[model samples]
Target: MKDAAFNQLTHARRYFEAKSAVYDENARGWYGRLTDALLSQALDLSVFSRLPDGFRFLDVGGGAGRWTERIATANPESSGVLLDVSPGMVRHAERRATRCGYAHRVRHINGDVDEAGELLAGMTFDLIINTHHLLGFFHSPDLVLGSIVPLLTDHGLMVSVLPSRWHAAFGDLSVGDAERARRSLSGLSWEAHEAPYGHLFTPGEVRMLHTSSKLTVDLLTGFPCLIYPDPPGVASPSAESAEDFLRDDTFFREVLAMETELLIDPDAGARGANLFVVASRVQPAEA
Candidate 1:
C-alpha cells in the first residue's frame, strides 16, 4: 500500500500553510516577488494585441490563488475560477481573492482535478492558466488536457508552465543532483513533484496531448524560471518557473522577458529555472 497522491498534495499544502506565518515573518519575501513576476510574464496582456475589457479565466490547482489574484488585478477585464484539490489551499485562495476584491468575480472549487468535469460542467472560459505546471496534479495529463481544453471558448488560450528535466538550463543544481531530488520523492507523484523536474517540460512536449485536446502551441519562453542562480529554494506548492535573483528593475525584467528563450528555446545558454509556453485552442489557418 502507498500514500495517495491527493494525500501527498494535502500534506504539502498543510506544510506550507503551517509555515506561511514564518514565511511572512522571516522569508525575505523573495518568493513573493519571484512568483508575481513569473506569472505576470506568462499571462502577458501585451501579447494579446487587443485584450478585451472583460474576460473569464481559470487557475487550475492554483494554491492560495496568488497568480490568479495578480492576473485579475492587472486585467480588471478578467474574472475567474480557482480550483485546487486541497481544501486548505482553496481556503487560502478564497482569502486572497477577497483581499484582491475579486471575490465576487471568481468561483472556488475543492475536489480532485481528475474530477474537474463536475466542477467545470456547463461552463466556458476565455483563458485558462496553470501557472507553475499544475499538470503534475493529474495521473494522466492527457485527461487534464483533454477534459479542460474543451472548456475554453473557441478562441480561448491555455497557458501551462511545467518542469522539464531535459531543459536547456539546469541552474547551479547539476543534472545529477536534480535527478537525486526527483528520485527521493518516492513513486507516482515523484513525477509531479521532483522527478522530470516536477513535470518540467522541454520544447515540443505539449504535442503529446490528446488529439481532442485541440490546443496549438503558440509561444514558449524559458525565463528566470528558477531562483537557483540566486540559489535558494522554491515556494511550497506554488510553481513559478524562474531562475536566480535577477534585479526587479524594468530593464532587467524586459531583458528576461526577451532574452531568456533566445538562449534556451532552440538550445541552451546560461540556463533558466522554468520555461513559459502559451498555446491557443484554435483551428489551423486555412491554406
Candidate 2:
C-alpha cells in the first residue's frame, strides 16, 4: 500500500508538471470560477474576520499560488509560504507572485506535504489553507493531518476543502430519479471511484480524521449544492462543453445564485459537491 501510494504521488506530480503551463488557462471556465467563489465564501466565513494582522500563513499544495496571492493581498501585513510537490507548479507560483509584486511577501516551496516537517523545519503557522481537495492525494487522512497539526501554533487554524463521498455517488443523479440514486448510494463507500491518488470522504470520516490528529473541527460546510447535470456524474462534463454551457451569462449567474443559497444549510455538506472544514489545534487543559 505504501509503495502504491508513493507511485501514485509520483505519477500525479508528473502529470501536474506537464499541466502547469496551461493550468491557469484551463481553469478559467465557469466551473473554476464557481469553485473559486465558493471557496472564497468559505474562507471569508471561517478565517477572514478572525484573522490577526501579521499572522503567518501556509498554503499546502497551493498550486500556482492563486489562493496564496489572494490571501497575501488580503492580509498585506502577513507573510505566506506556498508548497507543492511539482517543481513546475512552484515555478509558476513564483512567476505569478513576481507578476503581482507579492514576491517579497510569499515564499514558494516544492515539497510533499507528507514530509512537511522536514521541509518546513522550525516553522509554525497561524493559518493553513489546503484547498482543491488536497487531502485526497495522501494515502491516509491521518498522515496528512498528523504532519499539519504539529506545524500549527496553539491557536492556529487549518481550512481544508474535501470532495464529498455522498455527492460523488448521488449528486449527479436526477432530482426525481429515486431508483438510480438509491442504486448509486447502495454501492458507494469512502473509497468508491477513487482516482490514482485522490480519495473522497464522508462527513463522519472527516471528523474522525481531525479528532485522530488532536484537532478540533470548528466548522464543516457544504458548497455548490447544484451546478452540474445528473446521471453521468459531476466529473463527466468535458472542459470544452462546460465552457460552452457557461457562455450564457444569464443562465450562469442564475445557477450560481441558487447554488450559493443552497450552501447555507449545514446539512448541505452531506450531499453537496464538496465540503469545507475549519479545524483548530486542540487546546490543552488548564491545571
Candidate 3:
C-alpha cells in the first residue's frame, strides 16, 4: 500500500495535470498579476542582482515554468533545471521555454521533490526557487528541505513563497475576529484549494524550519497587507471578468504601490496572504 505522502503526491500530480491547459489563463487575473509583480521585485532586490555569471539555478515544483522562465530570461547566461512531479506541467514548461527562446538554458524534469536525492544525484545549484506553498504539501517538509539544502552550493540561496496563517487570520479574507480566526486556522489540515492539499505556516515556523536545516534566513516579507473583502451583495468575478479588471493599468499600479508600502510595515506586513523568504546555506567556519 502507498503511504499517505505518496498518495497526496499522486493526487497533486493529477490535479496539476488536469489544470495545465488552463493554468496560464487562470493565473493572469488581478491577484495573480499582483503576486507575480511582488515576487519579481523581491527576486530582483535579493537574488538576481547578486548572482554570479554562469550561475546554475533550480526550480522545485515549478508548474508551467512561470517563475523559472522569468529567472532564465533575466539571466541569459545562466542555465537551470525545472523539476515538477506532473508530466503535463513539465511538458508545458518545456514548450513555453522553447517558445520564449530559453529552451537551451533550462531542462525540465518530471520528478518528485521527495526524491530529489536520487533524481538529482551529483547535481548542485547556486540558487533554488520554490514557491506556491510547495513545502506545505509534503508529509515531512523537513526531509524535503534536507534533500534540497545539500543540492545548493555553499552560501547558495533558496527563495520560497508560502501560505501564512497570520495572513488568513488578519487579511481581508479573514473571519474578522482574531481569536476566532486563530481557532479556525488551528483546525486546518491538508485542505484542497487549487491544488490537492495545502498547509499554512507562521513566520516564526518558517524561520525555525530554515534554521534547523542549517540555512540562515536573509529576508522575509509579506505582501498585500491590506485586504478589503468584497462588499455584501457583490458577486465575485469570473476568470474572464477578473482578467478584464486587471487591464486597467492605472488601478493596478496604484493598488500594487499601496501593497508595497504596507508590506514594509512589520505589523501590517505580517497580514499578507503569503510570506516570501530568502534563505542562504551557511558555510562552515574555517578551522
Candidate 4:
C-alpha cells in the first residue's frame, strides 16, 4: 500500500480503537432497534436462509463481531473469520466468540482492509458481511472492493450497508448549509464528524462498483428511511424528542413496520440514509 493510504488506515484504526469498548452501545437505542429490524429483514431473504451446511463466511470491517456472532450463531454449522483494523475491536470480537461458545468456529484478524489480499489470501467466503458505513471510510473504496471481491467465491454473496451520498446532502440542507449540501451533491467529501477520509455513495455509483468487480447486484435498497418522524404541531424534533417518541412500544413497532416496507421501494437506495446491497460474483455462462 502507498504511504498515504496506509496513514489514512492508521487514523481510522485509532478512531475505531477508541470506540471499541462501547462499539456495540449504538445497538441499544431506537435507531439500533430499527437497524436490527431492517438487517434481520434482509437476512431473511432466500439467499441467506438457504445457505448449505458448513458454509464459510467473512465479516469485513465487522467491529466486535456483533453481526458476525449473530450470523455464526444462527448457522451453527458455519465458520467465520472477522477482519478489522483495530486490535481493540478484534480483541473484543475474540471475547464475544468465546462467550458465545463458538470460539472454535470463528477467528479474528487484526488488520486493515488494505492488507486483506495478503491476510485472507487463497481463501474464499460464501458470505461477506460489510456493514456500518465500512465503504465510506476508505480513501480508495474500489481498491478495497477489488481486494475483497476476489475472496468471494463465484457463488458467494456480499451484503453491505453504505452511507448514502444523497442522505448526507439532505442532512446538510436540513441544517441550512447550502454550500455543504452543494458540495455533497457534487461528489465532494462531506467530512462527516470531522472524518476527512469518509466518502459517501449514490446507488448508481455503488452499482457501477459492483459491475467493475464483475459482481451481480442481487438486491439493493435503502433502510431506515423514516429516521425522525414529525409529531403533531411540531415541525422540527430534537434528537431527544425523537428518541422519546420512538421509545413508545406502539410507535416503535409502527416505525419498524414502515421502515421494513420502505425496503421494497425502487428509489429507496436514493431516499434512504443507508444503502443496503446484496451482490454476488457473476457466474460463468454455461457452454
**For this target, which candidate reaches the highest TM-score against the unseen true structure?**
4
lDDT of 4 by residue, 114-168 (tens): 7888998888899988976787777667666777888887788888888778888
Cα displacement (Å) at residue 127, model 4: 0.5
Residue ranges of candidate 3 with Cα displaced over 4 Å: 1-7, 169-184, 190-192, 228-247, 262-269
| lDDT of candidate 3 at residue 285, scale 0 to 100 | 83
Q: Which regions of candidate 4 are displaced past 4 Å?
A: 1-7, 21-28, 194-197, 229-240
Stretches of candidate 2 exceeding 4 Å from the true structure: 1-7, 26-28, 171-195, 229-245
Q: After superposition, how far is residue 278 of candidate 4 from its true place, in Å?
A: 0.6
Model 3 quality (TM-score) = 0.85
lDDT: worst 10-residue window of model 3? 187-196
Q: Write the per-residue lDDT of candidate 3 for residues 1-287, one digit (tens) a residue.
A: 22544446877788888888666746455767787887787787778876788899999999889988899898889998999988889999999999999998898999987777788889899999897678777655655677689899885788888877655544323324555455437624333234544456777887888988999888887875554333224365545343455568997787778877765455543677778888898777899
Stronger candidate by lDDT (1 vs 4): 4
| Best model per lDDT | 4
What are the models' TM-scores?
A: 0.71, 0.83, 0.85, 0.90
* lDDT ranking, high to low: 4, 2, 3, 1
- TM-score for predicted model 4 compared with the true structure: 0.90
